[model samples]
Target: MSLAALINQLADEDTSALKTLSLVIDWVRPRPQETIASTLTRMEQLEAALTESLDVHLAVSSRLQSWLDNAQFFQLLSGLGLYSRRGFFKEISERLYERVNPAPADRNNVKDVLFLVFNRKGDDAWIHEVPDEALLKLLGTLWHFSPPALERTRIRVCTQILNAIEMLSIWVAAEELEPNILRLNPRVVDRESAFVALQRELAAFVQSYVRGLQDEDEIHLDHDHALVLIEQCRDEIARLQRRSVTAGSTMALTHLLERLSQTLTRIEHLLDILDPADKEKRTRRSIELFKTLVQASAERHGVRTLWRDNLRLMSRSVAENASDHGEHYIAGSRREYLAMLASGAGGGLIIAFMALIKIQILQLGLGKGVETLWVSLNYGLGFMLIHMLHCTVATKQPAMTAASIAEKVEQGEHGRANARKLAELLVRVGRTQFVAILGNVAVALTVAFAIGWCYTRLEGVPLISTNRYDYMLAGIHPWQSLALMYAAIAGVWLFVSGLVAGYFDNRAAYLDLAGRLRQHPLLRRLLPLTLREKFASYVDEHYGALISNFVFGVLLGVTGYIGYLSGLPIDIRHVAFSSADVGYAMSVFIPGVEAFAMFTGFALLIGGVNLVVSFTLALNVALRARGTRISSFPKLIRAWFQVVRENPLALLYPPADPRPEPLPDNHPHPEAAEAGQPPSDVTDSSPSTEGNR
Candidate 1:
């Protein structure tokens, strides 16, 4: 089918694509041995008659190729009459390579023509038969081909070349595209030098292509490949303007824009592919795309993870492009890409460990043991000291301040912060570090209590001996409690520490200060003025180490005191609450502390019942966090019955709703706006606004 015929079918003319396909099947597939010969004969006859009197060529090359694969050519001939549309080229290109080999000088010409044929809209009749590498190299070099100095060449030639470039991209990739088309075209090579001519234009084109792909998810990469094609056409305008500032420059740019207008149109094409009626197939495609990007080494740590391929291609193009143009290419690793992971992961783990031990020791009626605590705490602190020392020597964060963040934010134009009400899952990666810290703290408390319990039962001090069996409930002894205490302290501390280190090594943060300090303005945006801020944040994050070690020291101090002095016969209820038995004011004070920290373990026994009951005015100070000045505090307070009821991802990433990806403007929430601060506009269309765009 001709372009006109196909368009007519699309427009509901007498001929439709369905009818065209039906006709081909009826007439073409029957003859197996002589379909190609018959088609050729028919085309020759039509060409002869057309020259004599203009008439349609009654042979379809695209349909013929498709039939060649599955449908027989005879079947197509019976129904469509002579299918002569762009699809024929596509069919041919899929199955065969052009056997012809041209000389060095003619190589570019052949490739350019082939690209034009391959990019034909509607039915691709014969482009698929071309060799992949040869065709790709041809496609890569088109920017270098100089157009004829004619108005039509400016309009038709460039448009066709660009269209073809875009067309072939359906089979290629954005980042994988090569800019060597100009090299193969020879027009650029003949006139311009290797460094300052075609290479420069190729570089800029590469950047534009990559830039088009920005915000296009690498992981959820269901974006239109057609944009890559559209960009090829747009860059042609830029290429022409650079080639000749003399004439038609304005017209060329205008046409380029028109081509780009069709860019996003093909998103429908990809969506259809992803949302196929076959559910099994749809699932498979999603899985394939995810696996490819995830397992890709180019996306790993120590690599410039985000946009690395784009920059690499850009650099190559720039290197090959003209001197002035190549200067426009920018590429490097981003700064502070892994900071949040370090701070949250490192701090959370330590805190969890200490919290567990301390609470347990007190609850078990054991005084805090000092020796083991000091040893573990000291080791953790030493690591923090080293981490801080490294940051100090690096002098990074001050440079990574807001100005740097703004530049990164601009580049990440497509990413919208996932605004939502955060649950525990969002708040604490309890398993990652927060939970580890809490568990360790529990263990530490248990250890101190057990050791104290043993010391209290000793007949005498270490200088004097005592029976180890004093704590026997049945066969178990007091010394066994001390052993259990040691087990808790050593096991909890080491297990959490090692696990955190492994997580840091494996699932690194999005913006870690230490890892990212060196990469800014190159990999990430930076300001000389704010580099100091980065340094300061690094110092603050490292302080968790000091807090951790200090607690560790207290652990050892209590241990020493217990070993030396008999543990006083103390009841936790009396020490913690005081048996007024009347328990008047103590109820008020205890509930407050229990609600927040659950320190008394009574919070667990009653299940935050008292906390929920006593929640009052100050706690209700929150305004409606999101839109329309609607305050849902009462509803939210009631909802905590659920959060307090069912905690989720609390053990993974942060709990901030719209979990930020460790970049600037991380988690701007409804509370942020209510606090007299403008929330991050993720987009002008507030997600909840009535009729919001």
Candidate 2:
């Protein structure tokens, strides 16, 4: 309805206050595709119309006042804040349940009235989109039209705010006392600790504030000391988070810490809103709080948001572990670069034998299921052996190295110099990857060709039949086959395997697996003390890699079988294996030079897809988990181009005098420095030379 028409209707004595208020809201709301300026103009027009017509002004003023006076507000203050009284899992299930089956509204509660008035599904979207200045104007108009809230109502609201503070303090204290939190910070058990003192101070403040409210004397209460205590509690929470990096963290502990943090923040907001002086500031704070409550109510039933909110802490923990492991994958100096090449050569040698075994198994003429099982075991066991021998699979480096690069990007300061440093780091990563791939492809091809020649000479038959050779060539054909697509699939598995490795690493730390192994009675009885210690130490360091390699192999092996069962095209192609296949095919029958070049070009393309896909995926997750953004991307790209222009060979090979990159001042892992140990980047570790595949 038009503003004039709404004003005329509201001026009529027979129009109910509720219906009149609803009409005004409908008029003030933004129309579809309407600009915020247009909405603001309409709002001003409505306010002007009410000003001119005394009857309409009186109608809106009296009705809104009555509504405010009658509605209960405690639930609005305590319940609508971003918190829950239930446990994390229970809250998640309840939110999901409520999305499917909403509860009946409470007519007397202001919280319910908000949902009634903003009944549209996307009301929160527009409300959130509105600028703060526009919202303040709206609030000013409402305050001008409606009478001031009664003294009794003001007292009641203050009481509710105090009650909320009390409840939040209790929740924070209880969460802080959880066993996991105590393990992280045992000082929480002391009576003098911030967690305990916060509860005591809040109680005293409540009693004093309430007594002053009742007496109506000059109220003089300072919450600054209480705020200080809260800050200390927050520091303790931060300490717990830092300690969790080395001590390890579980989902339950993460959830508890997140809840405690939220509760403390809510308490702070309540205390700010409850100040008896500074009436104007209090009104502004209240309006801001109301907006927050509305937004929370709109999203209360969102399952995806709930899940994301709950998993954020745990994801960070896992990513932290992955980042630690990823540091070993980046080669900083010429020596490390050579070590990577040697590792790749070792892995390629093993992969050649694995490829031969796979071909022999295919020749068995077994059923699809049985063949898949044998191939999976061959790949899994081969990868595990490669890891044990400190070998490297060229394709697997991208997923791990990408995380290391992200850490650098995250730590970098925002400037041209930082961007240049990052670009230099990228150069190191690229050259390391290049040498590894070269080693893998060269060694695998050479070994496979020798094996095929030796077998044919001894047995008087070609190792690969002509028919099998054609099929293998066709499978790797760039345009004619799904080789690139299969390589992309393999890339995704590679990223998932990195996550699996991170998870097991976290599990090992959280469960104290090394400690358990060292103390196990069976190990003590079965082996000498030195052997047992060595075994436990080895397992602690290599457990995640061993498990990840096996799992990655299984995933690769099962894709084609899954495709066969479902009648779809699904498979994996690794560059090293494809190179071996090419060698075997050449041994069976020589192809033309063009065909051979085409085969090599497509093999490189497959490797490119594998690297790009996994690196992109892993880098995206690592950045998000760290809550870091490379806002200087354009500058970073420019820096990278400048480096390439200045020295193109730097990207393909290390410089003659390679130096180790120093750790940044704000390195994410500070525990090592604190322990008087060199940073992981500066020290060449055993894992640095091992296979990360």
Candidate 3:
């Protein structure tokens, strides 16, 4: 049927209004090509015809009054029990949908219903002039003729129409009399824009409140005034929602509601915090609450929010990579502990040789630019080779293993039992670290001492200049030098390297590095199938480790030269190299046993600082990234005491018979296995590109 005929039948027929309305919607909904202007014209004509055909003003009021006389409809709508109402709404909605079944895909029944109800904007002028009885009847009619109670789209439209009339009714009652001319109110536009601005002010209020609560500062604001303002803003938003029937209006309404809810919740929390309590307990309570809020903000507003899902991928990938490195730090039995010591000794031997090569590189007397490049290459290539050799640098273990520890902590909920497990892990890490340091230093000093003696015998002079030897001794003097601070700085670099490694590893897995490499045009055209596959697999597994090592080398290589150029005391202090330097100094410069003893003690102090700073920073970052909190520092200390008390030997020596331990969680998340642990891989990713000294 034609839309005009459908509308005429709906308005003129004495049949059920609901049935007539449904027939109109089913007839006129699908006109996707219709323009806004044409639609408005058609709707105006229908409204005029409908008004002439049916005495809408008088009949609608009486019909609405009669229908609502018993108040049964209100009971059905607002007070109906949940279970009964669901079925009631379902029956009404199904009857409507069945009439409109086999509807065209592009047909929008909700828009049609809205058009029929609000055929002309001028028709709403009657709402302001009508008496209370007529007004109430008009609202009831709008509700009764509402299309399909369960159709959310249509319901939303109907809500706006009713809400608009309700608002106009309120406005009319407030003004009492009306003028002939319709003039725009500048205040209305200003008020609406101000309402939007108030949303921003409300957000700022939340932030300021949080900050004030944290700092124990006074946040003086009249709560009643704020509440009144929020209500007004809400009212303005409702007005806007009704005036517009577009997706933009819907989104704005939704956003404003969310902000209002969040702001209200925050204000309540702030009030709770500001309430007077015990003096001793108040600060602690506030601090704990602030920490929780900060963590939530970090998760929501920080970098994690931009790539929340990706970080989960990274955490899993890094945890997997760390698990491989972690296994190397753990000794299965006494035999394995001894084997780790041997491996550390081998690592120390290589470092001593690297130190000797560095001295030769310095002696070449190249320009600063060439020297820097050569030194960078010397350290970068040396470290990468050391990693390939499967040896362990004592300081490097912390940066690599921290992720594994964090992952395990994340798997379990916070409790004394979990703390005990962490304590046990710490004990193993401690013993392993001590043994590795012992092996590295003992071999480094011996090998460097041997090299110095051999160079003296071959060249018939001191292997290193006396000035260079003296400078090394001065660098280690704790009080007289910046050695400890430099060690801490190196520790920061170690932490950064760990993050860089994790980031690259995340990229490899996420980007499907191996598959991409194999499918590359150059590789596909030039390489043998087996070789290309092998190369791709190698890069997929080891790219992060390899890149991290090289970058770390470059950072260490240029630091001293950069320090000289910039007139800063910035430098790195690695324990193995420091030990090697001390050994060389002992052979070439130290004249007495007492002097040698003092320098050796100083060197060990530097090593201790390096290990402590790097481990602490790396562990803190990894734990935070995994969202794992240790609960309390005192609890951790207590757990450590308990672990040591139960098995004193576990701290000093490896267990005689090691058994397989169960994974932390019953349904552990599976992670793909990555590459092995590599030594000297802890380097700062950012470094100056300037030449070395």
Judging by lDDT against the true structure, name the best candidate.
Answer: 2
Please give, for residues 1-693, the per-residue lDDT of candidate 3 as tens digits: 665566545545373433454453343232455443443444445445455645543444343333333222111111111111123235345536644662432112322223343343332332223234332332334344423332433334323322332332233222212110011123543343434444444444545544544455666342344455545655644454333211111222223333333443343333333334444343444444333332332232123232443344334435445544556677657897898888788888988888888877877889877888888887778777777787767777787667667766766554325777777888888888888888888898889988998778789999888778778777878899888888887777766666666657656755668989999999999999999999999888877777777777787788878987899888888778888888887777546888777777777787788788878877776675555666667977899999899889888787678566764332222241123221232222323211110
lDDT of 1: 0.30
lDDT of 2 at 403: 70
Best by TM-score: 2
**Candidate 1 lDDT over residue span 58-113, tens digit each:** 22322222222231211111111111122323424432433143223221232222
Residue 466 lDDT in model 2? 78
Clashing pairs in 2: none
Which stretches of candidate 1 lie above 4 Å from their native place?
A: 1-13, 17-159, 163-358, 361-537, 540-693
Comparing 2 and 3 by lDDT, which wins? 2
Report how far off residue 239 is in candidate 3 (Å): 46
198-230: candidate 2 lDDT, tens digit per residue: 988998898888887789784646688889999
**Model 2 ranges off by over 4 Å:** 8-25, 81-89, 145-155, 211-219, 274-288, 311-314, 405-425, 590-594, 627-632, 655-693
What local lDDT does model 3 show for residue 59?
A: 45
